[model samples]
Target: MIYFYNLLLLILCYLSEINSARILGIIPTPSISHQIVYRPIWKELSQRGHKVTVLTTDPINDSSLKNLTEIDLSFSYDLYNNKHNFSDKIDKLAGKPLEMVNAIITMNADICDEQLKHPKVKRLINDPNEHFDVILVEILQPCMFAFAHRFKAASIGVVSMDAQSAAYDSVVNPTHPILNPDFMLPLAGKLSFFERVFSVVISNVMRVYEFLFIIPINDKVIRENFGDDYPSCKDFIQYLDMLFVNVHPILSGIRPNVPAVVNIGAGLHIQSPKSLPEDLKSFLDNAPSDVIYFSLGSNVKSKDIIPSTRQIITETFAELPYTILWKFEADSLPNQPKNVKIMKWLPQQDVLRHPKIKLFITQAGHQSIEEAIFSHVPMVVMPFFADQEGNAKRIVLKDIAVKVDHKELTKESFKSSILEVMENKKYRENVKKLAELLQDEPMTGLEKAVWWTEHVIRHKGAKHYRSAAIEMPFYEYFLLDVIGFLLLVLFIVIYVSVKMSKLVFKVIFKLCGGEKPKFKRH
Candidate 1:
């Protein structure tokens, strides 16, 4: 028996080596919310005998994962933290579309710039011996996509949010300016005339700006690092092997994707519920009634909230009948209520999975919404910036949540929104249905992600999955060229017929009365 077991272990080792790949993943978005989406991916790939080298802001420094190599790009967060404070800008950037877009574009470029400057990253790029079967890069940072060019490997664009409008264009995935709108915009549902105009105008304007100004800037950065002979970032984007979008139809609605694009649902980082910490367990386990879990996610700190709003929240919570678990960063609230429990951090998934959790008051981050749905809890979304507003609108449209206007937030409005979702049976019912649909897929999201990643590596590239629309010009793809040709032919036929009719009229008149007309003219 011992001899047979040894032989089986040897056969398994041989198979692992035969199928193993060298994967390079550079997901340098400094947000923990973003990093969590891909963390599971790295772990899964390594466990399957792939040699994975990842450059990330949040490193899963687990020594147990012997096949994973994590390059710490945590300092990129400093480049952001030193330059800007997200807490201050979160509310201010809301509803300011141009400002919000410009900020995101600048930050993407800046992060890419900082990523190239890191000593380990520089060595990795400079090393002539380094090779990879595939490179997974952040779709947000086009400059970093140059790694694919340098390594001469298949490139897969990975985004932690729903695929943005510009991203769809890169993959030739179907998108409508008003109907599908950019995720960054706060617009959704049936648009009013002005809203439709705004969506169409802004989406086109940004598309042009991104192609002309942003891509050129990113291209220059790429050429600087990867050499001038490297292809333009625009060209690189057009040839992406595959794009992994963190979207599922259950939450984000039904959107079209090309064969090259894969929807690896948003709950990638969610793990099985663990035993809660003693303090939280005691607080939750003994709650007198139902509980409300409130959090604004990682980027927006609860302590940074304005004093007036804080007071309003405190006063309102004091009157509520249920227990409130507020993820407040500070140690204590000025006037804490007996029913309110403040914790600096939370195991959000575990907390939401608690039986007593009735409703979640969230900032409407995608992952947070996914967690709430997965746990079958409803939400009162207070969207602040970026995709949060759109996510809030989507969840509300799906009948799984309610939205509170952060701009007009008051004690009454805040309290009412929370109560509305908690008291309504429809919200809970809708969320439960959504959770079931999301979980009813043939393969789990993580499994699908791993399968697709390996598929690209196994085939060297997913060129067969590429869309013909990617190779076509905009006029041809929209059939405007064909339409123009038909219109031109119709015009020519009408012009010729008019001329023929006039000439025949003159001929008939002359033939009938030629001599009489000539005498009159003389």
Candidate 2:
């Protein structure tokens, strides 16, 4: 048995070494968790004898992998932008994904427009020797699909965020009929008649400007250096053929049925048998038997947690038998509960999988949900924005968890919700059941993603599934006029029938009156 196992391993490694993959870029946002996700797949690719280039501001920080190229994109992902008080302009779009989408489209157009003109970015674009077999683009919103498209390689887009629009495009969570059901084109769910028309107008305006103005300018710049005849990445969709979403369908069950959009999220278990950080392990050693893992995620700071709400959380735990392990950056809580434990950073997956972890209190981000479900732990979700609300509602609807509002949210509401999940037995059972569903995934999400990514490469770019938005007319694609024509015919037939019936009735009335008036057409 041992000899056969060794032989099989050797054959696998030999096969992998021969398959060299050249990845164009991984544009990761500076979030640590999001970065951790990309790390596994990137490392997997490199292990499988692939060359991976990550284009971002995140430096070569971790010493985990080789065959890597890091492009220092001199840019700030700062969301605050020198504002004194945190702005609500962006936050309000949290659960309302379509609003965030419009913002993304506009922002992407602006950023790309600016970056394409920069000397550094321009130089890279002009380089004739920088060709690659595949360009794996991280979908930096407002649509960076064009970025990979520009590189003249087969393009694949990856989303590493739990934001609604991104998750909606990637995962397929079973919706609760009461709270959430099947929605239409937009991530904000189905739009009204007027809203649909408005979306159409907005989409067209942005697209026309992008194609006519933006694409032409970028194309002209490329032509100035690359060659008048060479095609830009924007026009290379048929060439750029596949996409991989870093979402486990168990957590987010949406699967794009299209052949080109391969979602192999079953690979999340590749990093299984979770381990705890040394420091966090020490903290847990000292804490009580019952510990609830509380975190708002990296983007949203817990110290920024409103004091009024914090008091409610503190009081809620005051009555509970279990202690609270909160992830906060601040040194101290004003009125700390005796059972509460605060930490700057957490070994999240490690802790969630811990035997002592009774309940999870989270922002309900997609990745967080994935970790919790994989760990078979229930949660009390306190979502801030984006798809957080939708995620929160999904779990709550599943009878696996509860959600607390960030706006006008009270401590009493927070306390009661937490108590219910902590004390109630059903929440745990439902969560465990959901966990099993997530667990029984076809394969580990990471392996699925890496395998399919290389498969797309091995097959010379899976071109069959690309939507020809650039080629097909909007009307024909959506079939708007087909339905309109049918309705028009129906209306004309109805009108003709009504007119003939009225004529017949008038003739009958004339006959009953025993008199006929001669009428002539002039």
Candidate 3:
């Protein structure tokens, strides 16, 4: 009887089906890390029984599986095949990050407007007899904002990186806190007043951008494509209105939340943990000391790294009490050290999870950093560009990591930083404590994300979760004008008090002994 009951319970759990709906996931990741970041959400949505239609670019077409629709943008194909160093061209484009984003938006806008015959976009804007119910959209591409408007599907913006990943960083506020999720991931002890203020400002700006830029563009796209025949853009946008962000509140440093936005940290996306090769496992288990894993992300070529830095690592690992597994792209390291092992590709999360893996010297990319946090492994961060700098800063400031620059990538500095993380033990303890908080949350990142996603779907949109700024202008939403008016009133009162005080002092002096000479009452 007990066995029968247990079997029935298992059957019932397995019978759990998704809310009767299909989710059309539109991700615009032009880079590999971005693709990896979106993977968990993709997997979760699919596992939840939602058939996903994905539209994005991949340099090398990844192996496809059941229930996934992949539309490659070919954003990095030639670059990947040729192994080109063309990134300098993109980075050197002179503009603020927001301006750069605006440029990208306009560029895509121009393509849509100027060349309506383009095959890629024609398919996107094509009229389909069958309609999609919910559209999970990523913000990086900006091209897919038009999809929600055209299809009249519920749309949610999957913010892949920190709040700075969008236009809200320098525009009106700062989302620096969204980087590591702890109060600005303090420089020394805690976030300074200015840092806190900056973080608030970033949050405000992100809210503002979704309002001013994303919404208006989405509306315009729908208006243009459907010729006002489309349904109200507002209904569809705010309807499937969930902000599926890959952020943990603990690492974010701020627990404050906006309605409807699910903070799923890096979640399961970063951890592409695969079973280790038997040979590699044997090698590690046979090793005398703990190991250090080093890799710059996928887009960053280890072979392209200046030979000087490579030599520093090879020699430095030889001196340490540990082995080093460096993920190098090339066939082999020219001057090899016996203590160092080079593999073209290593299972990053799997290596980190190993009991003998002591420390990670990383590029401080958001995904890797979170993986390290999840595994309770400390980091020696060497941020290369963009948000890496911010991520590295947070790790160091949080006392869980020590930051060293690429320019400072010397044997001595690298060895010292690794040794400090290995020997001190506090860094590991601090990271472990944070990992506890991140893990002990009510739900796992993936679970929270899927539940909220289904909630948005079941409710037919997340309009309730939206920030009111979606319908209101920045001035009205933040009530900046009202605040200014109140400040002005306060200034007036202060001025009046000072004047009254002066008058009272003069009257008192005149009444006592000192005469009010050269003074007249008005």
TM-score of each: 0.94, 0.75, 0.74
What is the lDDT ranking, best to worst? Answer: 1, 3, 2
Worst 10-residue lDDT window, candidate 1? 513-522
Q: Candidate 1 overall Cα lDDT vs. reference?
A: 0.88
lDDT score, candidate 2, position 188: 29
* Candidate 1 lDDT by residue in tens digits, 490-515: 99999999999999988988898865
RMSD of 1: 3.4
lDDT (Cα atoms) of all candidates against the true structure: 0.88, 0.63, 0.66
Better of 1 and 3 by TM-score: 1
* lDDT of predicted model 2: 0.63
lDDT of 3 by residue, 315-350 (tens): 888888888888888898987878888889877778
Candidate 3: C-alpha lDDT: 0.66
Q: Please report the candidate that would top TM-score against the real structure.
A: 1
Score residue 67 of candidate 1 by CA lDDT: 99
Model 3, residue 491: distance off in Å is: 8.0
